[model samples]
Target chain A: MIELRNNELIFQFPKVHTQAVCRIDFQRTLRIPDDNQEYPLPPGLGSFPINHVDDFTDNLPATWKEHGGVFIPMYQAEALWMNFSGHYPCAIKIAAGKINAVSGTQWTKKLSNRPQDYVVVPDQPWLDGFNVSKGCVRQFVAMPLGEGYTAEEQLTGDAEHGGIQIIVYPMKHDVYVKYMEQHRVFNIGDEQCLTYAPADEMGLGAGGVMRQEIYEDDYGIDSWDQTSGLRCFVHLTNSAIYQKITGHPPLHKPPTAQEYTDSGLPWFDYYADKKALQGSASLSQLTSVAAKKIQKGEGTLDNNENVHPNTIKTIKKGRVVRDGRF
Target chain B: MTFSSYIRQSREGLKAQDRRFSVRQVAQRIGVEPAYLSKIERGDVAPPSEGKIRALAEELNEDPDVLLAMAGKVSSDLLAIIRKRPKLFAELIRDLKSMPDHAILRIARDVRDGDW
Candidate 1:
């Protein structure tokens, strides 16, 4: 018997010519922090919350809960958000469980080889109203590319400097297997070819709005390999929704190169203090007119700027140190 | 060696090989006209002036010195900028190259407007 629970498809298959039963489950959805809440985020990090799990899991394996059940986590939730919202940088975590230690071990071993820590089945369920698979379970350890930055670094305000920080939640082996099992038996009716509409065209129904065309990617899961895991569709709406969900403000207008330079934030200076150390160029040459304006009390820098007395002190100290080094 | 044999070997050495890039693609990357760049690549025209080469390097995301070397030209000012801030130099070049002509025009317009 097989069952669909919380977007994961669980099934019991008998060992060849044996009475023993093997159970398998797949993860389909993830959870992320609510938009209104201001949770701690890594610098330049953005995420959107996805609430539609059943829409994705309408075609479930038969009696999925009978064998066992699976549920989505915050990380998987973020993936769904990226898929529908078109956010480039995103991430999610997955958790699965099994009825017996033997089944759990076998499932874990099979899932261990999967790249990006695709499988992370929990030993026990954290929430009620969920059925745990006795013999087999699996979870996901998914995140968008470049999402592993430390909290301190995230808070340091350097996110915009790097190429748009893109995070992709690659489809995993278990997800493919689960999709095959359910799609193989189900009659999808008119939904056979899941048509995605542009986000603007999606109707606001009981299921909220179903954004379309947001998940378009040049490559599909079929093309995924060791190197291909970094690839995923970057949706534009995902950024808006992520800002909405994470309570982070959006970039109201595109920033110019001069604007970035004028921000006076610390940048990745490849030359370090080469010119300054050489004493060939004055600070006036390196500093933007905006910095000079701020120094002269003619204008104020943006909130992102850290023009503290200590910051100046550190620069002076660096100048002294570099002078000593020379 | 015989004069004829030496001449044959020297001619072979002087003959340039086709390096895979089309003139148009290189011109597009460097933000120049295909016809002009073609002439330069074929040595039918002399290398660009120093200021033009610096701008071309910024547009193509190439080290000014490398571009100059390829064209058999060099300038001390471009070399100084490269030496002072190699990463910034690279970034500025990339940014300039990646920006569209219209975007550059718009930025120029905005700068002009702000100046007024």
Candidate 2:
């Protein structure tokens, strides 16, 4: 369950027997001491302002409405970490667009104010790309709801798979409730409480299509009143999310950085801050307030079959297949 | 070359291309301290994580995997594959080590052609 209060988005999995099972604070920074030292995660910058895409239906594509999410923004290089202060352990997966970022336990299921896990952003931007120093990740950055970038366009693909998506893989609800009941934390049927089925039975079948999308506004001035363009979001992809999304065969251990470096290949960083990012303009002049018309092409599907099979009529008179088809 | 020397050479190559990319600027872009980055270049500290290595590679326009390999690290893709089928990979590697280039090529061709 997600609760937005006081500029902090709290992700609570009360019934899940997962680490960070209590309340996982999103955008809320907390100071916690761990085994080695203290990681005083800073508070998220400003309030979480969301512009619902439904309100701007006329200006967006038809698919925009189906993808129910609000536009959220993040500044370049800013870091946000999830802090857990709950009793149960829950695993959460954070993704930017569809790309897996980093997923792991936010903290151990210790019934204390200790942090089980945390992540710093854009440093490991996407699964395929890392150390992106410049702009938001390719997966997360979307053009305006109506504007989609072409598949071939690398750097700034205008329209894109938008939003910051987060999904939680909680432990079985019965197991969690039984454990909690034994521990005397029996607030089961409270208001707006949720009970999750066993992980495999949760309809997240093989594909693991469980995700929450947070959209972005690509045009006009943003809440900061700066020209709205490409913005970044913090995405976390942990082991559970990794397994669900990629379907990678289970292994005994995660890979160490040293193991990664031993394999000779080219690792690329594609952050916008490291590139020549165009500075956003404030409304210094009255003319800047005028709605700008960005020239955009229609959203084209990335597919090979252009003509529908239903549309083709078999004509016996001139039965000829073109383009060297046998 | 040692990871330290590799870093030094890569850093030098970056500077050689653009003098404006100071250690501080490069380090800040990659989210590391100038002192720490300097230590890395001079071989005073051990090689950094794959993420940091990637950041450095992007800044230097150098191949990140090469740097990572020098530092004895594996890429995320390979790591996932290794995790997925450890025994199969080990057996394949063992067999391939003794196979001639032409035999390996034939196997690769068969796999590509969906005959294996």
Candidates' DockQ values?
0.00, 0.01
**Candidate 1 docking: what grade?**
incorrect
Task: Assess the local accuracy of residue B21 in candidate 2 as a C-alpha lDDT between 0 and 100.
Answer: 79
Local error of candidate 1 at residue A231 (angstroms): 6.3
CAPRI-style docking class of model 2 based on DockQ: incorrect
Which runs in model 1 stand beyond 4 Å of their true positions? A1-150, A153-169, A172-178, A184-228, A231-326, B1-116
What digit string (tens of lDDT, one per residue) describes model 1 on residues B1-116? 43223322333343334332355654666577978765655556677676667665664444766666655665776676578679976876688787999765543222000000
lDDT of 1 by residue, A1-326 (tens): 22232322212112111111111222122221111121110111122222221222223222221211121222211212111111111121121111111111111211222222221111111111001121111111122212322111122322111111111132333432354235562110000001011111110000001111111122232422122212111111223333433344533332322343345422111112111101111110222222323455756423323211111112221221110000
Model 2 agreement with the true structure over A162-262: per-residue lDDT tens digits:
33434433334554465545767542211111111111111000100111111121111111111111111222222232344334432223122123223
Q: Fnat per model, in the order given?
A: 0.00, 0.00
